[model samples]
Target chain A: MASETKLSHTTALILHALDAGLVYGFSVMEMTGLPSGTVYPALRRLERDELICSQWERQSIADAEQRPARKYYKLTVAGRATLEASRRRYPLLERLIPTVEAKQV
Target chain B: MTARVDMVVRAFQRGFLSCISLLVPSGQRAEWRREWQAELWHVRRACAPAGAVSWQAEREVTAFCLGAFQDALCLRLHAPKNEPRIALLHGSALQCLLFLGGVLAASYGLTLLLPGVRVESHPERYQVRSGLIMIQDEAYSNDWVAATIPVERFRDWETTRQRYFDGLAFYRIGEQAVSAGSHGTGGWEVAEASKNLFSLLGLPVRFASQEGEADAGLPQAILSDAVWKREFGGDPRVVGSVLRVGGRDVRIAGVAAEGGWRLPGKADVWLLERDSEIAAGGRGHVVAHLTNQGRSEMWASYVHIDAYSPDEPGDNLCGFSFEERTRGPWGIYQFTVLLAFLALPAITTVSMGEYSVSSHRPSWSRRLCRWGYMGAKIALLLPIVYFLSLDVAYWHTTLYSLASEYAQLAASFSICLFGLRWALLDQRQRCPVCLRHVTNPARVGLASRTFLAWNGTELMCTAGHTLLHVPGLPTSWFSTQRWLYLDTSWEFLFTGSGVG
Candidate 1:
């Protein structure tokens, strides 16, 4: 079944990337074509009000060239509940929303 | 969920910590910083989530929130560590308080240890400017013998009696009266009959020799200590120096010690009995002797002349008994003591009232303790001040009385000091409830009906409020209370508080 959730254009893009596990700031920015200014500040505000949380990922490959430490943002329980509530309020938008692509753009 | 909650809680903790900086001024920024940092640590622990995710995100959220809250809350953008920094800024104020405390301690210590403070007592030197009379004459006995002569006639003496004799005045004599022409009777009867007449003229009878010879010559002269010392250098040589006194030569038989009389220090030269009789008629001689001796004997049988001149009559010129003289001087002492005693309690109540008014703003316990301390201080200080005031009053009355101007001036100064102490104490210990100045009725009534009803004038009451340091209020209240207690106690013991 298609996921019955619809977000705003920017929100939708952010959510789509987070759901696919491409949650780091750089990864989200690269996938959604959003600038660092728009992504970073929004991430911070969301995290502040309990809607989101961010953390650094542990490096798995010791030899991998060190990429700038990426902060991974994820929806909190309250944020998930809000997403669900919004889906119920706008069922028609949920139906017309496009599916998130699995591959990185 | 719990981990996310913990993170949010840590963020809010940082915000709250940062908010404290807003409460203090920029100068106190360092103090606020330390205070808030400690406070935030407590808050973070209290808000820590109970799960694995909480452990993972707590530190990051804490740091990030700390930065964000600092930015939002700090008014001055350039300021760093605003909350923590402000918490450390109390160094100067604390130092100032410590300095003041040290100074107070040192002053208190010095006051306790120092004996340099002089205890009030009788003045050593009396300025003699009033209450003195001088008689410039000489006298002789009825036998027509040159019994005494003025110092101006020293060359006429039969011998160098001045080398071994001093002059003297006679006021009284006692012997059985003998009718005229009695047989085998000695000259004692003559001396006895003349005693009453001489006493009425304020004069004293003197023995011509140690053998109490009734027929001895009457010498009349008084010498001051200063003259005696200058002439004899305090040696025995001057005791018998034959010198002219009041133009009559007299033997300096003996030296009279200083301060032998109550008269002001003015009379030093005396005339002989023969010279006195010559200058003043027999009637005048008798009258002068009676007056000089304070007229203590029968006046009807003796000669009596007014000691005061017709134009200027001095106080108590009429002969007064020792008791009567005491009464006059004692009146002044009584008045001083009365004022001092009354002022004592009045001053205490006012001072307490002032303290209460000023200290009301402190914590309840602190205020109560402060009031108690002030009360104790007043109580402790009262006896000291009372003794001091009494001493001052007594000396001023007895010693300064020699100089009317000095005596009056001293009396005035004492009264003014008592009044000033009263006003001051009233200002210091003000009532807590009324918040009015202790001495001022419009702001704070000086006399309360309830207080008066309870005979509270004797007992100091805390009443309305604590004392305040603000201007236009009594600044001397505390000191006044201390002085009042002392003055009152002293007056009670020394003067007797029948009036207060």
Candidate 2:
């Protein structure tokens, strides 16, 4: 089922953003330059399909930063494989989102 | 000022998210709201920054909140194929109440369409319209007795009525041997009335659709509802037929509606004669329509008219009373329903068994949902009972009379009592925590050994929220059923049970 599942360009951008360590929804929205309307549903579809997983961050970490705990998202093993296949299909998916090391810089 | 603006923006975003949460499946709604709220906090920090507001950034945050709708819609659409059905025929309180409401609306719609049901349901139309008065002599204190005025005096009043009354109508009641075509002759009470009486009183006499068909030479006759049923067998063709009354042939003009026009005493027929000798010398009853000025002076029991004089001085006093209207069937229904509710405790056990101490009291919103479910069921059931009783009472007969009135009262009272009992019983079977009807009742202990074991049936909430224990036999210690709330530790037993 995963092999035949085709990803739209918007979905590919969100997957690439997640793979690039843009783990939070706002960060993925910022990196992809996509409006929240396009980004959130794509993330949900990917998560429901088991291509991505999410969890709430520890409260202590958020307390130290003096903010509410954020829900974090990351590519699963299946998600990474799907993103590799999507890159071949979309061609310029790599250029749309920077790698984790590039994002840190 | 900027801080206040930020507060407003944040509130708007949160409110939008809360609305979107409703579209998500109930099991996932809380988690979905938590994720959106957390993201909203981060989005605002990045967009507006502290102590400063950017309209562009605020717009972006607004756009982010709007996105939650698509996500919630996606989740709701893709909700598990075998997701637990919210409405189990046994348990969903909301579904049950909504079903009752639908039935009520459908019944009311039917009442509007069916003529018999329509007449019984709306009593105001058959009642006497406002401002009708029965004029009587001062000596006639008893309203039951018909008071008469000399035809000359009535004609004088009709011609010279300058105040208090718009119009005056006269009718003299007398028994006449009446015979219809092939129907046996009977002595029927007949009213010899002026031709303009019905028009003056504004009473609608239902005539056959084909007008001007009756014999022009003969006088006209309007049949009372009882005479129409008894003599003519309620055939509409009876109109335009000839009837022999007091040895004179009269053409049937129309029929009076049931429960209509009870003034000037009861009569089976009204003879509308264009020119009658009664006006020359005979005495008859008088009914008058009050003018607006007459209405203003209605507080007093009698009106002193300059036109009226007596044979002896100080004996000219005359009085008027508003026409008495029949008690509406709807009033009887309301009275019986009230009596039924008051008698409910005497017939059935009214207490819903106490919740166990181990179970936490439901939160305020949960309590509201539970009680609101009961209130909605009763609200819908009442109209259903009312319309159904009207249907039962008037199903075969088109007439609204004493018999149908009694039928409606009995039907409404019985249905209301049983319907209310069922509502309370159904509410008792529901799980307070989830407001769903508890299911899977299994008898756990022996009925004969009630002293040692907790002898009763055990019912479980389908959602794993609680278990209900109903005693098969009552004891001093365990007289009523109780509910035990199940904690998360007991949830494993309900896994793969189609509960979300």
Residue pairs with backbone overlap in model 2: B91-B437
lDDT of 2 by residue, B359-391 (tens): 456778998988888888888889898988887
Stretches > 4 Å off in candidate 1: A1-105, B1-215, B218-220, B271-278, B281-334, B340-401, B404-416, B419-500
Report each candidate's C-alpha RMSD, comma-separated, in the order given: 25.6, 9.9
What is candidate 1's CA lDDT for residue B449?
38
Q: Rate the local accuracy (lDDT) of all candidates.
A: 0.38, 0.78
Model 2 CA deviation exceeding 4 Å by range: A1-10, A23-38, A54-73, A85-105, B1-76, B87-90, B120-122, B129-325, B342-347, B351-376, B396-399, B431-435, B443-500
Fnat of each prediction, in sequence: 0.00, 0.81
Model 1's DockQ? 0.02
Per-model DockQ against the true two-chain complex: 0.02, 0.66
Q: Indicate the docking level reached by candidate 1.
A: incorrect
